[model samples]
Target: MLKDRRILITGGAGFIGSNLAEYLKESNDLVVLDDFSLGKKENLSGLDVEIISASILDDSALNSIEDVDVVFHLAAVPGVQDSIERPLETSMTNFIGTVKILEMMRKKDIPSIIFASSCAVYGNTEKVPVDESTCPEPLSPYASQKLASENMIKNYREIYGIKGISARFFNVYGPKQDPNSEYSAVIPKFIRRCIEEKSPVIYGDGKQTRDFVYVKDLVRALSLIAEKLPDEHVFNIGSGVETSINELAETIINETGCGKEPEYREKRAGEVERSLADIGHIKGLGWKPEYSLKDGIKETIEWMRRSR
Candidate 1:
């Protein structure tokens, strides 16, 4: 509920960006810039705001973002598989686009930014519950680019006195998540399959654990971070509960009242065996997950059913 503030969300047409737009639109004057490569305009259908359908790499387009108080930089090429398949494009857009955004912020004297980083930057760390202290050993091109952007943001903060918070998001899911994408996460896919009474597909023995954070909870946390402007810039946004892929599939089936087992497939590459977040840093900001995994799943199922 940040009122009377001029805010800009870079990838505001994507799942997380659209959700953030919904959460903040009522109180703030919002502007969104997205190239429509991964984000769709329909995501912003109901909102009253200015939409600039252009890539962040376009300097002229970025000039329009001047006079904004805060920038929620969420635009990027988002996936390990996609990054692997197209490393040059991923690096070009994710890294260069961020650098360009930083340059624009410097030119515009933008005060604060909430950057959408990733747990993928932690990569296959040989530790449980990865924290901000963990050295990022990125395995994919996507993760490397994200790390590069985080470093840029941090450096900009240190040198320019601009408050920048890099939120490392976990497996985010909810309504408006496009299950049709090849790079979509497990929850949306699972719920979609369960709605159709089909077996959810599981990869890598289904024992791979992930820290799932509901979209609503995440946006709430993000809004809190934007409000707080904490000194601790990097924080992990997660549910603090780790659920394995098999258990997640089973939960989806049960939630949908489907008595079906998940279909298991070979493990994927460039993914950690277990992924969890040490949220001690973010908790210090007075943020917490408001939705339990069960309730979140229920809401997600309801959304999937309605959207279909």
Candidate 2:
């Protein structure tokens, strides 16, 4: 655990961010800066941490935070379909907002930042599992924005000496993931539907594969990155094991004993067909996911049952 250090998480009220906060808060003086547009206050309940209700674009909020040891830049306009519909807005948040954070770090002289990038940046790859060496071919505006932010972080690190590591996260799902949201991930939504004895919706052919890393496993990776500050600037944080949508739904249905079949629907635009992360980079840092798909899904289902 990172102790006696001040940490800032930009989107700390959301599912992943809140979980990360819960992990590090006991040892570190943590402050969460979020606009609460997508994040929920209830998510951070009972957590002893400061909350800054502002966006990353808010200069005042960025400036208010001082003496921060590391910054976890997780705030963004998430979701490819949402970015496809609102390209300009997504760019402002995902791209320009990153620039703002880097600028603040430069001014504040914060040494390191662990950026939460997405596997979407590696779009439609012919390669089975994408590693850090794979040339990026972003398919959507969100991916493009994330890629741009990665480059910007690289630039800042090279020129200004601000250490930045971009973590390309695969499909992350766990507790506090809002299934009611329009842009929610498949796992939480599937778990919720199964709990309610309803059919989970499957976009496209249900064969689209994903590397699902549990949220706790992901936060451990993030915490490790913060603690060690590895030499590498990029790492793929995932379970590495590939699972298709059909298989994922089957696991959830079996867990809940909700035998409703998945309802097929038209494929959404700007979504990747298959995704699998080569997590060797982060694994080299002595970090690996502890949860299997079934284990993670069972934990998530229990959380949903209690929260619902």
Candidate 3:
């Protein structure tokens, strides 16, 4: 819906970033900045956009790009486990990398920025549906970094008059999500195991819940944010549907027709017990996820089957 605008997507070749690129490319002049450390070139297959293969941390690389309209900052060391094992790497990229992007935007005079924030910033809470106003209790380095980035964005908005919005993403899963990586998300891993007819590994008792938002739906929310530029700076982008891991595994197994059960394992540290998004804020802006869990899983399974 953003027409004739030159847009920049940091980590533009990653799962969510690439999907956003595909969604917006028809109307907007798009530029993707990625280091390919975690992102893949193959992900940008059919997108007709300029690809800048450089680190967000590179000052020269960040400065070289003169972006016009807005920035979708999606580049980062993306996993909680990765942040735990590689705190320095995660902080440098997720936290410092964001600072670099903001600096570039400021220098280039880019008016708007939509940040790819995570729901991990909420940590484990007794509340079923965590909203933006909920006090942040970041449990992992990754969560802390996202929280810090959100704050930095807020400060920049106040000081520099840059219009910034942070979309606190819940569990996002869909096509192109790598299941092979050690730091891969649970849905992709579960889908991969289901396709292989192997037991999907469950890190806990399998009762921990999460609100999964389809990647396509999330990109739509991003587009909406770009177009509307709503007053609220932060919005929770999710399905507003709380589903346990056990239910998710079952859904994937059924969708893939793999008929494998989930294998229980010791609960990992820094893992949240439950999560659901209070999406009322975003919904008020005339946006809500269109995909249900079963449908989204079926689509993801089909994509995986074809990719193999």
Strongest candidate by lDDT: 2
- List TM-scores for all candidates, in order: 0.97, 0.97, 0.97
Instruction: Write out the backbone clash pairs for model 1.
Output: none
Q: What is the C-alpha lDDT of each candidate?
A: 0.89, 0.92, 0.91
Candidate 3 residue lDDT tens string, 175-204: 999988878888888888888889899988
Model 2 accuracy (lDDT, Cα) = 0.92
- Tell how far residue 237 is off in model 1, in angstroms: 0.8
Better of 2 and 3 by lDDT: 2
Worst 10 residues of 3 by lDDT: 59-68
Off by over 4 Å in 2: 268-271
For every candidate structure, what is the RMSD over all alpha carbons to the true structure, in angstroms?
Answer: 1.2, 1.2, 1.1
Which portions of model 3 show Cα errors greater than 4 Å? none
